[model samples]
Target: EAGVVQSPRYKIIEKKQPVAFWCNPISGHNTLYWYLQNLGQGPELLIRYENEEAVDDSQLPKDRFSAERLKGVDSTLKIQPAELGDSAVYLCASSLDAVASGYNEQFFGPGTRLTVL
Candidate 1:
């Protein structure tokens, strides 16, 4: 099977500039997720979507970050007026319905690396 796809694989920005990242999940998957990973840290969950509904997003920084999965498929995450602390790797993952009868393993895409100056 093909893996998830992300564009620009790397990004660099100065603080206060807006930034956006795109994600495309694996086919036949209905659940999508966005996560953040600081250097030397495990990926932290940002948001999870069951199709078009964001089922979990408590960890997302609302002041400058927002995301959407309008078609319950490809997703986009945006940071307006970015901050230096926002420099981290943004990852996208996909899995079968989490509650489905089976082991639901999250398959990750190559992350978009953002560096804020």
Candidate 2:
């Protein structure tokens, strides 16, 4: 079933520029995730957080990428000084309390595609 989705499905920017993406998860869902998908590859988790607390962000590129969940609701992901390698589809997902719900289904957004020039 189709549900969550991102805005400005496509974006193009010059190298070294910055970009941001927004996500609004399903109501009542307490867990949110951000992922990056390269061409011909599966999406990889960049960050996952519960409420406003980040629980997993080891895969995120701290040097250039950052994410935040505001008031445990809407979330945003950003990239600064984007490079050629940063071009990819950024996906957002949400689920029930991940730690307590044990394997809850994740609802994913269509994703925002970024192209660096």
After superposing candidate 1, which stretches have Cα over 4 Å from the reference? none
- Collision count for each candidate, in order: 0, 0
**What global local distance difference test value does model 1 have?**
0.94
Give the per-residue lDDT of model 2 (tens digit) for 30-98. 999999999989999999989999999999999999999979988999999899999999999999899
* Model 1: per-residue Cα lDDT over 82-114, one tens digit each: 999999999999998987998799999999999
Error of 2 at 68 (Å): 0.6
Judge candidate 1 at residue 79 and give its lDDT: 97
Candidate number achieving the greatest TM-score relative to the actual structure: 1
Overall lDDT per candidate, in order of appearance: 0.94, 0.92
Report the Cα lDDT for candidate 2.
0.92
